[model samples]
Target: MLKSMTGFGSATQEANGLTVTAEVKTLNSKFLDIYCRLPRVYSDKEVELRNLLTQRLERGKVELSLNVTRLTDIRPGVTVNRPLVEAYVNDLRNTSQSLLLDVSDSDLFKLALQQPNAFNSEVSTASETAASDWEHIQLTALEAIRKCDEFRQQEGHGLESKFREYIQIIADRLTLIEVQDVKRIPAVRERVRNLVTELMGSDEFDQNRFEQELIYYIEKFDISEEKVRLKNHLSYFLEVLAAEEANGKKLNFIAQEIGREINTIGSKANDASIQRLVVQMKDELEKIKEQTLNVI
Candidate 1:
């Protein structure tokens, strides 16, 4: 089945008191190009994530981002060092006594608490938290990838339908060209015969040489070979479009072949009617080329 390169997906999950979200977006590209935005803790996993995307999506310009938020408190903000506070308080009390000054018990306690090393603002270790949450983040990313694939499938279906319509229009125009070709041949012959008679006096013209030259001239403008080749190219295009594997490059190459055949027919067809039909085929082929860029 065909798939489009343009799509978007995201997934969010909660684990280990953290909320994690994974988002992915893709666009058409000749090769797989990945851009990653990750939290500092998961920086080491960027290579693994890129490999996963490459294996799944194959070819595209891909952008992935991982976001995290704390959902619950994992540690206290601060903790007091009881022994350090007591030591400071004892030293302060001794100094007050030697100076013959009395200090309130509450004041001494307050002064000790204010001393450096008495308490510490807590900082949770990220290594441990990241190790525990990695699994959840990976699973969320897989889910997002699946959703993006589904989006590609839907867009591809629409493109396929359009392609079928455009191909049919070109086929219809080819038929018109065939019909006009038959009428064009008789008119061309009559005009060429009259010109030959006018250029060379009828009595003086050599009949054998004239016949040979006329045959050669008519063969040069004959579109029968071009018509057959064009028909084959059109059939091949439809066959590839129906294949099980989605090969955008192959399909694009076939389209170029189809255009080549159409151009050959246009240039060889001396009739105005055939030229008009060729113009219509060219228009439809251009549309097909434009839409194929988004295919995968």
Candidate 2:
């Protein structure tokens, strides 16, 4: 039931000659982030719209946009602030006369206020609903968002399966190391015996001192503790992955722990087989770590 933090949704509604629509898309993020683009008149609805999005989403960088059209008996129209335009024209003419400038007939003032935003009128229609009956539009938008979440779930399931596969590979490699390390301790003991015998040749090296030094040297090279801790970390990582939420950061931390233990084991293990297993485990772990960066 895990979900990724990336998705897309869009919905449209038409009510009594009023059409409104909403679209949302998201990307993975450590926290819940929202950006909205709404029409100027409906700017007041921003808080309510954000609340609706937060209800369904827990974490991600989300972008939302709203589009509205009026489809009533009324027709789209434009209005111009004639008084402002005339005032600018009169002021410019007076300035030109006072300065004695030989300028041509000017079209600057007329051209300045011609755009939709400069003196544009608000949308109005036979529909009484705000921004073309947005109630149904809100519902449609929510449904689209739900579908988006479903897709995220499907994708997250695939990632979960891949995680299990790589972790299993690492576990199998660890098992190989465990089996081959049995002879390593015996080999170290024999080498210690040989070195002591050579050093004491007719010189009478102390047996007690030699035994103590041998114990210290073998224990220092032992990777039993590292192996046990590494196994425990690997188990914890799998458990975290199964949780029903966005655990990307938590999973990354667990992977770090696993890597630390693996490196420690690699450095301490003196046997060729153990070293080979360590390399294999590291390769698998690195792959898992790379894939985890894309997880939500």
Candidate 3:
């Protein structure tokens, strides 16, 4: 079965006063392009995380984010800058006195806390703790990637159904052309005979020469070879669609062959009904091409 390049998944794990959340989103792309955002403590592991994502997702523009939050007061990493807070509070008091204004202590404290450097959160760098935390993050990330694959699989099923529908439509159109093709040769012969008679008069027109030229002209418009080739290409396209591996590029190449045959038939059709059928086939093929871009 095929996979789609568009999907999203997220997972969160909590342990040892740390809550880690992993999120992954993907969009269609010709190659694997991964972008990551991780907490400062895990910055060194960014390359490992990227490798994990690349291994799971073959092709797409992938955006991954990891968020970590501390939940235990006993292990709090954040500390208030007492000297900075006191300076802010004292400055606010002096300004209030100079302006002859009254400010509550609670208000002054709140304003002081909002200043830059009032508090700082220390990033944990202990090798043992980092290793354990990385394991938790890795498991969470893998879970998110698994969910992403599940989503892609679901979308792939939908794409496969659509491809079958479009292929069927094109096949039906070819059948219609086959039926209409029978009347085409005779109509061309008769039209050529009438034109020759009208231009040179029946007595002047050479029957033997006209017959030879007519055969040549009609052969130029013969779509028998094109029809057979198009049918074969369509069948091959469906065969590849059911393969075990994702062959989006291979399918695209097959679609191009289908289009080449369709274009040849259209150019040589010289009949209104066949031309219309060719147009419809082109429409269906265009839809398939558009959807194939999302396949993996």
Candidate 4:
């Protein structure tokens, strides 16, 4: 089944009093590009997480974020700077006196606590919390990635439907071109005959030579070969679309070939009706090209 490069997924897991939330999003890109936002404690796991995502997502611009919340009051060492707090209290009291405002001691203490560097929470050098929560976090991340892949598959189905619809439209236009082509030849033959008679200014011209020239002229404008090749290309495009592999790039190349054939037929047709059909076909092919870029 085909997959699209655009999708989003999120998963949450809790273990050892730590709640981990993982979110992943992807967008269309020519190559795999990964960006991660991880909590400071889990920073060391960035490389491993990137590898895992790369293996699963294949190609796209991928963004991942992990947020960790402690669910329990128990934590590592944390300390209050008593001297800093005293300094903040003194500064606040002096400011209050200068402004002739009376500030309560409780309010001063609260304001001092809100100051930067008022307290320090020490992170363990061994990353004990990160190590303990790694397993649960990994599982949550993997589940999110799995959901993202499912989202991609769903998007892919929609894209496939559109591609098939556009291809069918192009095929129908080709049919119109074929029908018009049949009538075009005889009309062209008559016009050429009239023009030749007018130029010679006589009805008694070399019949055999005129026949040869007319045949050459009609053959030059014949679109039969392009029509056949275009039909085959349309069939091949559907075949590739049905395949299980993700062939977005391959499909794009085939669309380009289809465009080339359509352009050739339009230029050689010399018929306004056939040219109109070619224009319609080109429009459908352009839609296919646009959707193929998002395929994976």
The model with the greatest lDDT is: 4
Cα lDDT of candidate 4 equals 0.90
TM-score of 4: 0.76
For residues 73-177, write the lDDT of model 4, one tens digit per residue. Answer: 765466788899999999999999999999999999999999999987667833675577788899999999999999999999999999999999999999999
Candidate models: Cα lDDT each: 0.86, 0.77, 0.89, 0.90
* Candidate rank order under lDDT: 4, 3, 1, 2
Better of 1 and 2 by TM-score: 1
What TM-score against the true fold does each predicted structure earn? 0.78, 0.72, 0.76, 0.76
Model 2 error, position 200 (Å)? 5.6
Worst 10 residues of 4 by lDDT: 121-130
Evaluation by lDDT, superior candidate among 3 and 4: 4
At residue 230, candidate 1 shows an lDDT of 80
**Residue pairs in steric clash, candidate 2?**
none
Candidate 1, 1-296: lDDT as tens digits: 88899999999998888888999999999889999999986799999999889988888899999998888876656789899999999999999999988899899999999999999665565545556778788899988888898999899888888888998998899999989888888988887888788647767788778887788778767889888888888888788788879678887888999899899888878778888888899999999888888888
